[model samples]
Target: MRKTALFAALSVTGALLSGCGTAERLSRIGRAPDMAPIADPTRDPNYRPVSMPMPAPQDARNLSANSLWRPGSRTFLRDQRASAVGDIITILVSIRDQAELQNTSERSRENSESMGIPRILGLDSSYARFFPQGFDPSRMIEANSNNGSQGTGRIRRNEAVTMRVAGTVTQVLPNGNLVVTGRQQVRVNHEMRDMQLTGIIRPQDIASDNTVQHDRLAEARISYGGRGTVSDVQQPRYGQQILDAILPF
Candidate 1:
């Protein structure tokens, strides 16, 4: 009874806390979702610097005497690829995945045991006359057992997504890799879509037009989601989510 009362109290407290958002939504019943303000990504409280193992720095490239062409330069003019912090680069995102798996397992066991005293210190001969009719000491005890079990499991999944977004070079690692971060938001009638991407890419991977493919980015983190009338209706209530998380069954 005490446990049940405590759980009920917690549920009520959670519902009350979640009601604050509900009240805000109610005030904007007929209005479209507000768009987020434009701000510097580096100023965000969640922003953090990226660090990794780097090899020792190498000496600068030596230039030839009176040569206009520089060694290791992709073009005679200044290279246009994004190599420094605060530069913009376009990212082309494309993903497609499909998987299927099935598993089965089976187990079985059987055992039998028996024990008897056919001739123990002549006692069986002495008690033979007094034993019950059709009784046999050779089969005094016996046991038999059998066990079996079987299980099967299966999984299937498919997903596909394609989009493009411009990202800013947030940092330049000691090894010449560039860290990039980008966010895109679109608001439609009573709905909003949000997308975010962050990763590191090598300078050589950038094309002449300043575009890089998603596959070239390492340690990538991508998110695509939204929140609005349709999204709210599709999600479970706060109380239901709390119960789903805490309930044993």
Candidate 2:
């Protein structure tokens, strides 16, 4: 009997351990993934840019002394713009919007239709004799309608993120546009905030200070998010969320 009890206890313990492992793995979801930057673009074992339609890369042209400015040329005299792969530049983030509208409308309509039977037709006196004082053949059909609608809508939103982060130029397109990507993570007191950006930018868009505005970027994919213990506590439990998704009210 003692041996059987020991066996049952061991089995329960094992089951509990297995459940804990699974719960730990699932709890990591929505938390920041292993926060590792790509070691190399081309040589990395798993570093492939998303497959999408992009401009074909153009071939370099031979330059002579008479050529004042050749594409992708790095001259010793002028300021450098992020035109080539592996170059870096800073991006400024800015955003804001607001609007309001109101509409008022009112309408009223009345319609009355009637037919009279004259004394010559020999019906007016007989109808009046049979009818009460409120009854009248001249106002046989009457309809009154009133309809009014008024609506007002207002919207206001203000969001701004002003920070600078150096981004590497990942690809240079044929037309001299640079594909830039950057990611930054800040961790403080168990909370981690991550910012990432990827976009195509023209060489001329980079100012002499080597910075470009976020609004100027084309095909920009910017994401600002976070993950931490605080964030996890703010979200519903996985079991509750699953029930909410699959269960009908």
Error of 1 at 94 (Å): 1.2
The residue ranges of model 1 lying beyond 4 angstroms of the native Cα positions read 1-12, 126-134
Itemize residue pairs with steric clashes in candidate 1: none
lDDT of 2 by residue, 1-249 (tens): 999999998678656645784576477766543565755444556545544465667676677777677654466555477767788799887754344455555555555555653444666777757776656666655566555555555555657676677788887765667888887888876678888887878887888778999988888888988877676678775556657877999
What's the lDDT for all of these models?
0.89, 0.71
Q: Write the per-residue lDDT of candidate 1 for residues 1-249, one digit (tens) a residue.
A: 999999999878986879898888888898888887887888999999999899999987788898888765677867777888899999998988889999999999999999987888878866657875756778889999999999999999999878899999999999899999999888988899999999999998999889999999999999999989999899998878878998999
Error of 2 at 200 (Å): 0.8
Candidate 2 residue 5 C-alpha distance from true site, Å: 32
Q: Pick the candidate with the highest lDDT.
A: 1
Q: Positional deviation of 185 in candidate 1, in angstroms?
A: 1.3
TM-score, per-candidate, Cα-based: 0.87, 0.62
